[model samples]
Target: MIEADDNENVERLRRIEAVTDAALSRLDTEDLLDELLDRVRDLMRVDTAAIMLLDPHSQHLVATAAKGLEEEIRRNLRIPVGSGFAGRVARTGQPVVIENVGENDVVSPVLRDTGIRSLLGVPMLAGPDLVGVLHVGTLQPRHFTPDDVQLLQLVADRAGLASQARLTMIDRTAALALQRSLLPTRLPEVPGVDLAARYVPGHEAGIGGDWYDVFTLPSGWLGMVVGDVSGHGLQAAVVMGRLRSALRAYALECDNPADALTRLDRKIQHFETGNLATVLYAMISPDREWIRVSLAGHLPPVTASPGCPAELMSLPVDPPLGIGAVQVRHSTVVAFPPDAVLVGYTDGLVERRGELIDIGLDRLRAATQPDDAETVCAVIMTALAPERPADDIALVGIRRQTPAG
Candidate 1:
């Protein structure tokens, strides 16, 4: 028979090996917990085991992985901080072992249902903060020795690493969903114009700094704008969102296209990182007889009316916002016959894999030709979309009202 001392040593070594293996596996949190619970059950000779992670916002301990526990109980169970025995361990950032958990007020009946009479739980910590709990339970009344506590503590460390990884992934996914939900589902219908919009984020699915929006003003003018924040990812997305919102508010409240952009710059400066962005705004009348367009360090859109050849239209730009406020010129032009399509785009559409801004603008000018609004937008995207886009791409197209049919 193995001596009691030798048995303890063997168990300790086995736990050390388990933790070492877990660290090397780099398994994501879900799989890591499965392995952890399996190791805990074998080492402690327990009937059941589980790992619970605390929801940062809810402050509730919810089990994420388990063995030998009722699926329903594990799914629905959540203990508030300091509510039950496990909760107290999480609250205190310590370990606790109860020999008769069935009789302990701190033990929930959900746990006792598994015939669990003994319980041991330790905090899973990432840095100094308690992230979750690592727990083992036995059906029969028994004592958890000091060595058992130490072994479980080691496992708790592994759980902490896994918890951090899982939470990060979850957060990024939710942020992306929120950003995508905020994007326009379809372009607005302009009576005389065909509209199409596209947004392509980087490989990470993060909100790219690019954005586009179109809305009809009460004055029967179709308000349009496109802007690009200086960088990429969530920060850029936030700036893009703020710019779009502020522009909408300004467009609805003010009729002057230049003044609307000026208001948008002031609002955006308050929230944007570095208070910087390149923007283009235009107000088109319902009859498409005139357009009042303004630029703030943004790419001027391409214009081509029916029966006319395509050409790039350049507008004077106020330097990008947040750098410093400069006088925005009033270079509003009237379209002859009021029947041209206006395309607004970010620099991503024209910039090459490694090239200068002027080069991209030059390419864009070269590419423009008299074509349908949708065709023009599609062609620009196809021409500018990189083999592997390093940044977000956004575009909006509008055409003046054509006479019936």
Candidate 2:
């Protein structure tokens, strides 16, 4: 004969373990969330159940999954951490229950509109990181007990991992597709100029901000670009894409490399606020005798000429995009002697853990010599790139044809 309280406790225990069910873990990353949210609503007997995940860039919790509160997800509900009910749960990293809800208690209007009266929320943790907040709401007033809070937390802990994995997987797939489609498949042929490039994603950070671009202007000037946005995952990749496109458009309009970068900086500061990135733009003359370059907080490119040792180019520096002003941008011209080779790359090529980045840069300089573009790319990649890097790397090489060419 089981007592009523014993039966209730047993039910709670059963629901808690259900979160770790083997079959539940095997479900598809995306479907996992919807299924979990449904089970949560049923288990808690709540009118609404929703999951809000952190948006690292904006420092807000964005509604990702919901049951009964479907409109919230559609509206892309965002709650700043430390502001309201869910925000308080995320900030305190604890369970919160409100027997009676009010307009003053939450930042999202969806809750008030839904007429939700009682709410119980818990922090969704993936190891030590506060990945999100999971909360249940009821239209009728209810006093949530300790046992109820614990049960919701159990569900939230598992939901955190599933939601994080699903979002990361989706973002990574989209980023890879964008990179493959954006990067040039075959280097263009320019009568006396040879070009080659290489790109590799980091093992730890995965697909990130590193990118390279090459194109010929209608004015017969050759444009080369290399840039690295500061951050990782899909957000960084998307920002990189926008900057790349914007720079290309600006390149068409601004004849000078400095003017192009100045415009790029202004665009980033105006539209993509709070993001930072380094970029280098180089424009070679039609005759291949001179190259004008603008660098914004980027490492200098290495140049090697026939019968001469490779060395880093000297250029005036400005703050990275999103930080620099139009007046701060400047361009410098360098002699592009016949048969000279120039290689531009992201910091990932030369930066290493615990070791001075100068060492890697010096190694790259020593490895390169006046050679064909393909040879220069091969040598630099072979000499510097690791089997599994800590950050993404992008490299591009250019060589002017000699008399023999």
Candidate 3:
């Protein structure tokens, strides 16, 4: 005959393993917590279980998920960092087990209404920082054990890791979706601009730092920008979003192309990143009389017109933003004749393997000859055929329309 206590102990250990395994299986926090709270009720022999997560502001712990609490209480409850038992556990990074909650001062009066007599709470900590708390409360006046607190704490630690991972995934997904939406849905129909643009996410699973935007400026000038931050993945995507939004705002507010970029760089300095970004900004007007171009550590743009063999615009500018302090010069305005074409691209287009960068540039320049803007884009994409692009590529081609006789 087996003792009741021994059998219960074995069952509790089995439930602990199950909860930990379930939490580890999920990379997302919300899913992990859902599984965790369900398993906690089973493991602790409790009526209900809940998981609270620290808000970004860190002022209060919100009930992110619950297994058995009423919809009304669960929806409305937010425990301040030092208000209840769970709050104390979060603030002090300690585990608390109340054998008799009716005698305890920290147990929330709200839980009393739920008829809970015994409660256990554990801080969910990542390293030394506390993330939130996990708790289970029972209706019967039960004797909670040290092993019970330890088991919940182990689960809480796993919950912290899951939460942080999910938070990062959410942030990257939001920024990438917003970035894609902000980019031109379809290339604008400009008289002389042949634009072929492609945005490739980095080798990693999340969003890439590369982006391009083409739109009409206030003064009937066509604007184009292609840029790449130094690193790949989420951090870069965040900075890219900010830079892209600021550029659009500045372009509307400023008069000159260089001034827009200069203001953009200054606005972004508030948030520091080791990653540097290379940008090429240009404005083209319909009159076919002039083109304003500027470069900041980006590949020099190629301009080719009939009778004028392709030439690279190699104006010197400061290194990419975040390399160090930078000062931008006035944009160089070139005399554009009728039916001229200009192609602008990121370094990735030129840095493909199996051929030198110069070879790629020559190939691209060769494809830019006596064609309309759309045909020019198709020709270059064909030249770089098979589409095995390792790095992100963005290209914009602008051509000036010939005036009617």
Candidate 4:
């Protein structure tokens, strides 16, 4: 009988470990906690199981997931540090076993009312930090053995790691959404011009400060801008939005691309200190015969005429925005013949680790330059970014439509 009992205990622990592994594999934090609680309750033959996660800002343990507990109790429960059973375990970063909760003053009235006579609580530790608490309760008075405590602690460790990853993913997802919201949802339609744009986020970082915009100016000229702010994540995205708005306002007031960029540079220098961004702005005339381009420490724009290969235009480059008020900027005018295509893009399109920028530029020039704006955009993206790129990419292309006979 002794041997049989020992075998049974070992099998129960094996099952618990298996379920813990499954829970850790879940992507959603809440779902993983819920599954963990359910598995704990069943594997330990306990009446109830729950997981309480610490709110970093509030420093309170909130019940995130639970099994076999009243919905009202689970939703309304908040345990402060060093207070209740779970709180004490979280505060001390150790396991606590109660043979009889009714006799313990630390047990909350709500928990006592649920007929939980005995309980076991363990801290979920991720390295040196205490992430949360995991607890199980029984209706009848029962003693929790050392083996039970050890098994629960192991499960808690796994849960803590999974929770941390889930939180990081949630933060990235929110940042990406904000970045997308700030970008232009659709390009404005310009007469005699076909427009196409693409924004591709990096695989690892998820979002960065790459932006593109196309709009019609007051003088019936089509205005286009492509820019890249230094750095990645939410802060860079906020700076990009501010710069984009300021450039649009300046572009509307000034006819020359260089003048608008100069004003934008001054605005950035005065307001956003230490923030630098490279930008290329172009203004296309209403007749679609000429385009004025200006560069602020950015890559030169590319032009492709009918029956000719795509070539990068040579233009004088100035300092990027937010440098200072002294840097001089200038504009270069180029003839845009019929059935010509002009493209502006961020560095992500032509940048690779451990390679020269000229190599990427050569690849970009070799890409198929179709007459249709959308086709050219698709072809460039396919040729340059076939997989998850290491950096964010922003591309804007304008093709002059051939006049109908």
Model 1 global lDDT (CA atoms, 0 to 1): 0.75
Compared with the true structure, what per-residue lDDT tens digits does model 1 show for residues 1-405?
569989977867877897778365677667877888887788778888887788776899887778886572446778898878888898889998888874554555667665677888899998988889888888788898888898889889878877887776665566466567667887776677667777776553445667777889888988778887776555566666777777888888887877887777676666553757888888877777777888887778778766676666756766776675666645476573545667778876777655787788777766655456677777777777776666667777675545752
Ranking by TM-score: 2, 3, 4, 1
Please list all clashing residue pairs in model 1, or write none if there are none: 192-401, 310-370
Reference-based TM-score, model 4: 0.66
All candidates' TM-scores?
Answer: 0.63, 0.84, 0.70, 0.66
lDDT of 1 at 376: 70
- Could you report the Cα RMSD, in angstroms, for every candidate shown? 7.0, 3.6, 5.4, 6.1
**lDDT string, candidate 2, 81-122, tens digits:** 998999999999999999999879988888888899999999
What TM-score does model 3 achieve against the real structure? 0.70
Per-residue lDDT for 6-98 in model 4, tens only?
Answer: 998799768766665753584477777777777777778899887787877588887777786656254667878888788889888889998
Give the Cα lDDT of each candidate.
0.75, 0.89, 0.73, 0.84
Error of 1 at 96 (Å): 20
127, model 4: CA deviation in Å? Answer: 8.5
| Residue 183 lDDT, candidate 2, scale 0-100 | 78
lDDT of 3 by residue, 1-405 (tens): 469889987887786788767435744566677777777777777887878888755578877777766552455677789877788878788887777775454545556667777778888877777777888888887787877887888888888877866776777788678667766788877665455565555443355667788888767787888887766555677778778887888888866778887776666565654667888888776565877877777888888878988878767665666665675545878877777777877766667666678987787777777567778767776776335566656677777766551
TM-score of 1: 0.63
